[model samples]
Target: MNGLRVAVLSFAHEHAASYISLLHDRTDVELLTADPDFATAPADELRGRGFAARHGAAYVETYEEALAWGPDAVVICAENARHRDLVLAAAEVGAHVLCEKPLATRVEDAEAMVAACDAAGVVLMTAYPVRFSPEFATLRALVESGALGVVLGGTGTNNGKLPAGRSWFTDPELSGGGALADHVVHVADLLDALLGEEAVAVRAVTNRIVHGDDPRVRAETGGLVSITYAGGAEVTVDCSWSVPDGAPTWGGLTLQVVGTGGVVEIDPFGAHVGGVVAGGAEQAWLGLGENLDALMLEHFLGCVRTGSTPGPDGRAGLRSLRVVAAAQESVAAGGAVVRLTPSSAR
Candidate 1:
């Protein structure tokens, strides 16, 4: 296949910068970026700070004009609320889509995005790049090969430092619910990839612990969520933004998966994986490949050429969002456990 031509729709999402860098550096891709109202203070500041790359790519005032650039696929990096409309538009225009996490704020819109892509007969992949992480892939292969025996449950944690530059992220409407909604779904998607099944229930506890000292923000700084998969496997997810600034250990994301035979632990920062051995714990660290964002771009382009389905497709994202929505609903309803509809087997 020839090189893949791609364009980005919005620059609101934090990961947009990373995507731009990936596209800029990849020789096989021709990248364009468009963002309406780029002169806004926030947008300009982001550009100055290097978050908005693809400065050479054509910029248009509206998305419709941007789509006319002849992109083979579109990367929808808009705000959570704008994802549904943007994805539908891309699919309608006959372009495959690579949308950021949390496909849409609502399940109904997510379903619509899925339907749009299905009707258009183009791919609609969600960015759950964690599945491609070396540690995660290794653990998944082990479990699938029965090296870990029957699976039981897993524990995942990602206590990232607070987002500093992006002020809009504090707005629940713009960024979605909070920490649990932001981070837990990534783990849910990863669990689905590893277990080859969907999550069936969610029971979560969320709280707004940060006063935003600025007195103007009210985003959550931390939370815990427990998810139950269809095969009876459970996952305890812990995420927060409380890690202190400039600390040597700025943030950490780790996972511990248990099986009938043994346990597997993954430390993403170091790309390390460890297993419990007879004497103690044996560990191995993986070499990084620039970062996950670059790897994700490569995977997407490869899938486009090979006619392969991206694992975290629109339906997969919808499944994760259903679990997230159930978790949010559970938290609102006094922490009551919520039962989710089984995902349609894809």
Candidate 2:
């Protein structure tokens, strides 16, 4: 088709900025953005028109206005709980979607979003930029090629500082859970893509001890989750918001995979030079490598134009959502094992 008309539905999530920045400069993309929820945002927070203007994208007053503009596709970056409504709205308008992660706060809502997009004959791609990392690609290649032999178990971590600008990240009602919800999905999605095996069980432990001093922080700030795949491979994920405020970067993800033949590890964000910059008050890390978000967006837009399915599609999102749901169930049961029935995994 001709140049694509795309709408960015909200700016609640931090990644929205990167996405807007990437799309704004693309000549083949006509970008429009809306954040009606911004009306109630704190005065100090950048949202709505100001955020859109800063990113050099066209702004609309509401999601309704943006959808009515007839976008061929949309990027939904709303709060976790708000994803369902935005996704249904986009699907109703027959617009392909690339939704922000943790898909939804609940499994039923995620299932509904997937079904709506399927019924509308529109693609629903989940935002999982980590899958686009070259380092991760190499890991997947090694695993697939039997260089790692039969996978036994592994340890993964997706840790970061508590989100600074967005209060919703700590609100369970808006963000789903906490560190578990915010960080688990990326590694879970990666494992799912790597193993292609159903997750048979999950056990998780979470605590609010990290930010317990803040009354507003009701959700968990630290967690450790263990998942068992159908093939008997167990993976433990430390999805915690444990990075200190003074850290040079927010945080990073790393995975150590152990198999029968050998072991492999990947640190997607490790390609960086860290030191104190000249005349700078604090330490700094200059990243080196391809931008995973740009690669992910390019893939999504390519699928949009070709009418092909996107990797980490709605079903992939649903699978990872189930893992989080199971993890929450396990947490509620005092970290007891929560077995996932095959039907539930689907």
Candidate 3:
């Protein structure tokens, strides 16, 4: 009921900047900051850009010390590989956690994170801000209300240009994988929210058609993953980073849902009216709609106050990641259909 005290864990994931913006803009949230290492890529963007000190919040050197301030929750913005330890530490300190998704590079760690949170009685929420996008909300409501009749399958795309500033995104060791790892979770979580079911099987394909010029890139720049939900509904997610630097609006989601009754299409970022200023100059279509990040922060804080279940809980993240892992496995197995096991289910 009172103001929500929050701490941001890391800025390794660029989305932390957006989360910082949302938490900063909120009057009901008292924010704090902690980045374990100041010499890494995250620190360069967060500290060099002065986002860490901009709000005048107390800054700590480690996540352990950040919890000393007694925050009700902490948003873990660390890399995919770092989520487990940060989440376990936060949950150990009796703080709810809101973690950036693709919860872990490995399903085992993800399951462990959820178990730790469950053991500590702290909610572990996976950040799925795309579900918070207002336009996306309406679409989910429509499909759930049976406006689409018998649901068939949906297509989701979250393609983007190379993560120019954040090089770790293309580093398999840091981000898990290229397009398949970085991009798959968003759509998987979307399907989780919209369909209210789990993906029973997955088949994926990954390639390096783009970003071949860079020797530093070890991850594929493009990927297409097909998911088969429990109810027999199917969907394809395009999590490619194939767009050019000059593409409009970084990258946006294009979702097309098909059903026996009719079809629904959504472009969450396209509602913003913008024109091309200079194609090659970088600033393309700018979003003028309501901010999804702000809405997500508000929701997370509200859930903390009410002790409500985090909408997309850690289990939900694990589910999405199971699909991602399956996709990755499928890619490795020559695009074979990967069957997930019950023990893997949360």
Give the best candidate by lDDT.
2
Model 1, C-alpha of 185: deviation from truth (Å): 1.2
Question: Residue 146, candidate 1: how far off, in angstroms?
Answer: 0.8
All candidates' lDDT scores?
A: 0.78, 0.93, 0.83
Model 3 misplacement above 4 A? 42-51, 54-57, 278-284, 343-346
After TM-score superposition, the amount by which residue 213's alpha carbon in candidate 3 deviates from its true location, in angstroms, is 2.0
Poorly placed runs, candidate 2 (over 4 Å): 278-280, 343-346
How far residue 29's Cα lies from its native spot in candidate 2, in Å, is: 0.5
lDDT by residue (1-346, candidate 2, tens digit) is: 4899999999999999999999998999999999999876678889999999888889989899999999999999999999999999999999999999999999999999999998999999999999999999999999999999999989999999999898889889999989999999999999999998879999999998898899978899999999999999999999988999999898999998999999999999988899986688889988889999999999999999998999899999999999999999999999999999774443
Kindly list the per-residue Cα lDDT of model 3 for residues 223-284, writing each as its tens digit. Answer: 88999988889999988888877666678788899999899888887776665565545454
Give me the runs in candidate 1 sitting further than 4 Å from their true place: 37-44, 47-56, 211-214, 248-250, 271-290
**What RMSD does model 3 have?**
2.2
How far does residue 271 in candidate 2 sit from its true spot (Å)?
1.0
On TM-score, who's better, 2 or 3? 2
Q: Pairing residues by index, what is the TM-score of model 1?
A: 0.89
Q: TM-score for each prediction?
A: 0.89, 0.98, 0.93
